[model samples]
Target: MPNCNAHDPYTQVASISIADYDYPLPESRIAQAPCAPRDAAKLLVDGPSRPIDAHFSHLNDYLPPASPLVVNDSKVIHARLAMQRSSGGRFELFLLEPIEPASYEAMFAARGPVRWHCLMGRAQRWRDDTALTLGSHPDETLRARRIPPHTGGEGIVELSWATGETFAELLDRLGQIPIPPYLGRCATADDNQWYQTVYARHEGSVAAPTAGLHLTAPLLRTLEDAGHPILHTTLHVGAGTFLPVKGDSIGAHPMHSERTVITRRLLQGLLAASAPVVAVGTTSMRTLESLYWLGAQLIDSQGPAALHLPQWTPYQTDRTPPTAESLQALLKRMDTLRVDTLEASTSLIIAPGYTFHVANALITNFHQPRSTLLLLVAALIGARWRALYDHALRGDYRFLSYGDGMILFNRNCKKA
Candidate 1:
C-alpha cells in the first residue's frame, strides 16, 4: 500500500502526462545482444536515500541479507513462424497462445489441425486459402486463415501441420525466437539460449521474463546457500507487453490481459514469507498484485466478477485489504473450492499513485519510453524513474530485453 491514501489512485491528479515519461534514447543505446556471461550485466540499485550502480553478479550486495525472490518461469517458445505464399510472398506468424485447446499441455500435444491466436507481419497479402509450407517438407504445410483481432491490432491465424509431432516440436523445427522489434534485427542462433532464462521450464510466453536472465545457476545456488528462497509462478507474456502506450493519459488506455497461474503451494510460500518478497520481473509483480485483487474479489464474490481485473481496477475504488487479509481470503476460497491452483487473467495497470499490494522490491530490465512498463517502474518509486533512467544511461548501461538489469525498492512495508 502507498504511504499516503488521501488522494485517489484513479486520476493520480499530480502525475505528469505521457510526454513527461518520454526521454531521448538513441537506437544505439538499445542492447542488440545479451552480455556474454548473463550475470555480468550491470545492476542499478536504488534505496530510500541513494542509488548505486553495480554488476548483477553482485546482486546480494544490494538486496536484504535474505528474502523471497518470486520469479516468472514462463518459457519463451519459438513463437515466430515463417510462411510462404504461393506467390513466394513471405509472411511472418508469431503464435500468441493456443485458443482451441487453451491448455498449454494439450495444445502442445494436439496433433492434427489446431487454431491459435497469432500476430502477422504481412497480413494484408494473405488469404484464407493460401497454403504455407514449412521446412521444405510437404507434411509441414498449413493454411493462413484469419480470425477477428483479439485487441490492439493483433490478428489470429489458424494453422495445422500433418506430422505427428506436437506443436512444440513443430515450432522447435520451424519457428524462430520472437525477438522484440525494437532490437531492429532478426532473431539469431545466440537468442535461442540467451533470450531465455536458465530456469525456464514451462513453454508459453512469446517473450522472456528478462530479469530472470541474470540469475545463472551458480548465482541461484549461491542465493539458496545464503538462505533466500526462490519461488516461481507463470505469466505467459503476450506480444502486447512490447506495445507502447499511445494515449496521452494512461487512464484512457486499455490494458492487455495475460494468462497467469499461481499454485496453492506458491501462494502458501508467498503468504508465509518471513522476509521481503522481491518480484523478479514486472510480469511477476503484476501477478502478485493481481493475486491480491483476486483474493479481494473472492472475499465478496457476487459471481464471476472475481475473475476479471479491469484496467483501472486498482484505482477505481479506495477500499482494499491490508495485504494479510487478501491472502487469507484467497486461501479460504481455494480451500472451499478444494483446488490447489488459481488460474486467471489479469489486465491490471500499475500507474503512478497505484498502491502496491505485494512485491516490496523489483528486479527488471530497462524499458522503453512511454511504455506501460515504464509506468510500472514509476509506480514503484514515483518520479524517480527519470533519474534512474538517466543514471542507467550515463553509466553506459544497455537498455531493453537482453540488456542490463536494475533493482529498486518501495518504501518499507511489512511482509505479506
Candidate 2:
C-alpha cells in the first residue's frame, strides 16, 4: 500500500526542491498524436495486485462503482489570430481572456469593439499606436489596437470589426485552435475536431482538458449504464497550463488564475455522493477542490461578495470543516444570491503538502516532468507517483497531451 502521510500543515513541501520531481523523458516517448479511436488509448489502472495496463474502454472496470465522474466541459476556442501591420510586418495575437465585460458569455456576444487580455508575438515590432488589421472587406474587417498593460505586463488588445457578427463568430472565421506548443507542429484542419473533447459546450478555454479528450460518447454512455453519474464544471484552461516552474523550489513559482463555473446541480451531486468523486482532468480536480476552500471562506470569514480564491489560501490554515458542512455553506450562499451557477476564479496550487477536500480519484494523461501537474499527482499518492510514472514509461505508453491516461486512487481517500 502507498503511504498517505505526505500532508504537512506548515507547507514545508512548498520549499522542497522542484528537482525532486524531475524525471528523464526521452523525446521518443512523447506522443505527437492521439490514438486512432480515442477510447482505444491505453489506461494505467491501480489494480488489486499492482498497477494494471488496460485499455481506456475498460475504465468502468477500475472505477469505484457509482462514483460520479466529474468532467471539465469548458470548450477550447479558436483564439490564435495572425494579422499584419501597415508596414507588412506580421504578428500573432493569442486571446487570453475577456477584460472589458469580464464575463466570457457577455464578451463573446458583444458586437463591435471589445477588450481582451492578449499576448502578442513580436509585440516590440508593432508600434503602440498602429493597429493590426485582417480581412478583405470593410464590413468583415477585424482590427486590434493596443491598450495599457496590466500590472503583470500582459498586453491588452481591443478587437473591433465593422460587421454585426459577434466576437465568437469573428474568431471562428479567423482564429486557429491553440494546441499545446510541445506538439511541435501547427494546428491542422484535423485539430479543429481532434483537439476538442466530445462533451465540450462552453467556449472559453484556449486549451482542451486533455484527459477528457480520450472519452467518446459511447464510452461515456457505458459509464452511465454502469451507474456512474457524469457531472460537469468549467475551468477555462489558460496558456499558464504550459508555463514552466522557473524557480528551483515550488514556493517561488506563481500559479495562474483561471475562470471557473460550477452549477447548482453539479454541487448537489457532489454533496450527495457516497463515494469519492472521479475528476476527469487536472482542471476539473482544481475546480472541485477550490469549491471547498471557497465554501470554507463563507463559514470561517465574512465571505467576499464574489468568489476569488488565492493560491496560498489552502496552505494558510488547517481549519478544514467537514466536507458536507463546507458544501452546505456554498448552497446557502447560492440561495441567498438567488443564482443557479457560481462564477469564480482560482489560483489554487495543489502540491504534496496540500490536503484535498474533494475528488479522490483522477483520470488524467501523463504530464510533463517537473510540472505543477506532476506535483499534483505526488500530492495524492506520495513517493509512489514516481514509481507509477516509471511503470508507464517502461511499458512504452505514450506521454503528454496526446498520450495514454491513468486512473489514480488517492491513498488518503477511499479506493475503488
Candidate 3:
C-alpha cells in the first residue's frame, strides 16, 4: 500500500514484518488453569529502567498515583453448543455474532428461532438442508440448520428452539463457555466462572478478556481506596482474537471489528483526568484509543448514526488533534443528540508505529507470538517489549490466559 502521510508513525508501523514480533513460547509455559486467589498471580512491572517482579496483589504499588483504570466489562456468553445428527454423529456450533436481527440485545430477547454467524466443527458432513438437534430434552427442544454464508464467506447457522424461554436462557442451559483453544482441553465445570472476570456484566463476548481475569474483588477495593478511579466500558471480544497473523506483513492481514459501548460518564472521566488513563486489557486499550479517532471523526462532522471505524483511518490522515479537544467534540455531539451511551464498532489495529492518544499505560497478560495483542504492546513500549518477554520467560512467569500479567507504561507518557 502507498503511504498517504510519509511522516506519520502508522505508515512506518503498518508495513512492519510480522516475523519481527515472533518469539519462542514453550508449551510448558502455557497456563491451563488460574491460581487459586486471582490476586496471587505474578505481575511483571515493566518499569522505566528495568522490569520488576511482583505479585498481582501489589499492582497498586506499581501504578502511578490517581490513575484512572478503564476495564472491559463485556461478559463471555456460553457460545459453544454441542449438537447431534439423526445418525448420532456429533458436531458443534460456535456462535460468533447475531445475524438475523443484527443486534445482540434484540437477538437474546428473541424467542423460537434466531440466526447467527457461526463456525461448525463438523461442517463438511452438515448438509445444507439437514438439521441437527441438541441432546434430547423432552421439555425444551433445540435444533440447528446450516444457512448460506455471509458476504464475507463466513458460515451462518439458524437455531430454532422452544422452551418459552429467551435465547439467552436456552444458551445458559445448553452451551459451554468458549475458552481459548490453546488450553488443549474441553470447557470444564470450572470454566463457567474461572474464565470470566468478576467485573463482567454485559453478555456478548465469546472469549474472556484474560487480563481482567487476574483482578479479584479485594484488589478492586484496594484500588478504589487508593483513590484510583475504576471505570468500565464494553467491548464484546470476538473469536478473531485467537486468529494468527496469516501473512508475512501486517499490511496483508485483515483486522476484525468488535462492538464497543462507552457511557457519557466514562467520557467525562476521561476528559477530566489529571493522571494517566490505564487500560486494564488489550480490549479496553483498543476501545479507549478508538474513542479518540471516533471523536476526531465527529469533529469532521461524520454521521453519528453510522459510526463504524475502519482499520486504516488513523494511517489515512496526519491530522493529530489534542486528545481533550477531540473528546470534547464527542461530548458536544452527544449533548446535541441527547444520548447517554455511544455504541460503535472498531477495526483499529494498534501496531508499532501507532501513536497513543488516550491510554497512557496498559495492564495485560502475555500474548501469543506474532499476534496483534503483542503488536499493541510493541506500540506502547517499542522494541523493549522483547526484553520484557525475555525477562518474564527467564523468571518463570506463566503465559497466556489463566496465567500472569504485567503493567506497561507508554514511553511517551509523563508517568513513565
Top candidate, metric lDDT: 3
Per-model TM-score on C-alpha atoms: 0.93, 0.95, 0.96
lDDT head-to-head 2 vs 3, winner:
3
lDDT by residue (129-164, candidate 1, tens digit) is 666656676765655566654454366667777778
In candidate 3, what are the lDDT values of residues 276-387, reduced to their tens digit?
A: 8999999999999898899898888755686778888887786777888778877877798799887789999999878889999999999999999999999899989999
At residue 290, give the lDDT of candidate 3.
Answer: 92
lDDT of each: 0.81, 0.88, 0.89
Clashes by residue pair, model 2 = none
**Model 2 regions lying over 4 Å from their true place:** 1-11, 149-153, 414-416
TM-score of 3: 0.96
lDDT (0-100) at residue 174 of candidate 3?
A: 92
Clashing pairs in 1: none
List the candidates ranked by lDDT, beginning with the highest. Answer: 3, 2, 1
Model 1 C-alpha RMSD vs. true structure (Å) is 3.2
Native-to-model Cα distance after best TM-score fit, residue 369 in candidate 2, in Å: 0.8
On the 0 to 100 scale, the lDDT of residue 341 in model 1 is 76
lDDT string for model 2 (308-380, tens) is 8988888777688888887888889889889988888999999988778789989999999889999998887
